[model samples]
Target: MTQDSGVGRICQKPVSALLFDMDNTLFDLVGAQIASCQEIVRFLGYKDGEELFSYFLKPVHGFESHENIRQYMEERSIPIDGMYEKACRIYETEKLRHISPYPGVAETLKYLHDRGYPMCIVTDAHSRDATLRLEKIGLLPFFSGMVAYDMVNVKKPAPEPFLAALEMMRAPAGDALLIGDSIRRDIEPCARLGIRTVYARYGDRFAAGHQDSGADFIIDGMDELPEILDKFNKI
Candidate 1:
């Protein structure tokens, strides 16, 4: 469909099924993650939050896995599983309580849901974690399904997860559009199946004009999506 939208003659292919990335795409992962890390550290009994953050920021510990963290705690003579469990407990009990959906997300999702769009989430995070993240934010009910890395053993930037979500939704890749923030991961892979893409322009780490400009369309925020649909209407 095409419409005389602000940018130009809008051309949107029919989109019966909409797939999204859950991490930085849905929630502000950088903000939520910073909060979660602080809460987890405090739960581990380091009353001074800065100390734990300091330890974690050390180059060797940066972006370590749960198991790597467990070993890190072990190397310091701390109980591995105990602290690990404590960290996870605090994240669930406390960190989750602080998470907020990005502005306009709920209303946008509701609008799409009300319009009979079959929405689904496909993210690179662990399956269970992405599920819980959505549930924590109260947005899980609007989705038809979800696909995560842990489930498929292959993440986006690889076609596996995106293809899996399309298959789960019973939609062909050509008819499905992958809308997300990451250029390399989301836009490139979905393009493999002739799937179009929409870049969530305000998402984390997005350059004003990214290094690789691959998305078929771009919107600064959820509020602009109605226009995107209008663009779709034109085609």
Candidate 2:
């Protein structure tokens, strides 16, 4: 169950499975998220839309959870009944409208799928939302399964979601490689479980480099994955 057809070698340990982070890994989630936030800000008629979005969506200190958003709005005395749900609805709609897979993602996934590599999506997103984006990008069919945030009632970096995905795929940690953009969420957890990791540099929304990230390999783009795997397979 190895493939080396003019690509590089497969991993020496035999990579039977791949776990991918959905946002900012397989697709340009940053762009989609920005669009979604813009729609919400517009709907709310914020005069300083960008500043407001940045204040709320800043990478480190910004709010991510619905509860956080609600709390922020409440503290600010923003009077919009059911504003959270409305924002969510608008964001989801706008995100879908702008959703797109990163360059070469579809081809790479198809190649791996054709080579019989089982793939699973492990995301901090809700199942329905993840599924919608995956389906929109045409990458859903290639995945053997998915582990959403709600599934394990925890996010990445906790290892529960990663483990849940592996369990569902019946793939051992050593036999799996996780490709993701976030070191904190994807790489750290997988590495703790003895799963190999490939840091997706291209999808790094935070623009963090490989300085302290313990990734097994670093790839600039998804197109380089097959070759990297081939080289690893031969090692």
- lDDT for predicted candidate 1 compared with the true structure: 0.70
The sequence of per-residue lDDT tens digits that candidate 2 reaches over residues 1-235 is 1212222222478887889898889988768767777777677766444544565564544344545445545666876587778876876688788989888899999988988888999998889989988888888999989999878988778979988988998989889989998888887778889888888878886764546557777777798889867754642
Task: Provide the lDDT at 43 for model 2.
Answer: 70
Model 1 / residue 214 / CA error / Å: 1.3
TM-score of each: 0.78, 0.84
Colliding residue pairs in candidate 2: 8-230, 9-230, 10-233, 11-232, 11-233, 12-233
lDDT score at residue 130, model 1, on the 0-100 scale: 76
| Consecutive 10-residue window with the lowest summed lDDT within model 1 | 1-10
Q: After superposition, how far is residue 139 of candidate 2 from its true place, in Å?
A: 1.0
What are the per-residue Cα lDDT tens digits for candidate 1 across 1-235? 2112143322456776789987667778756546766776665655544444445446563332444346546666777655678775664555456667888888888888888888889887777777777888889989998888778997668988888888898998767767787878787777666776777767846475555446777766776666676555532
Instruction: Let me know the TM-score candidate 1 reaches against the reference structure.
Output: 0.78
Count: clashes, candidate 2: 6
Query: In lDDT terms, which candidate is top?
Result: 2
Off by over 4 Å in 2: 1-11, 55-64, 67-78, 82-85, 232-235
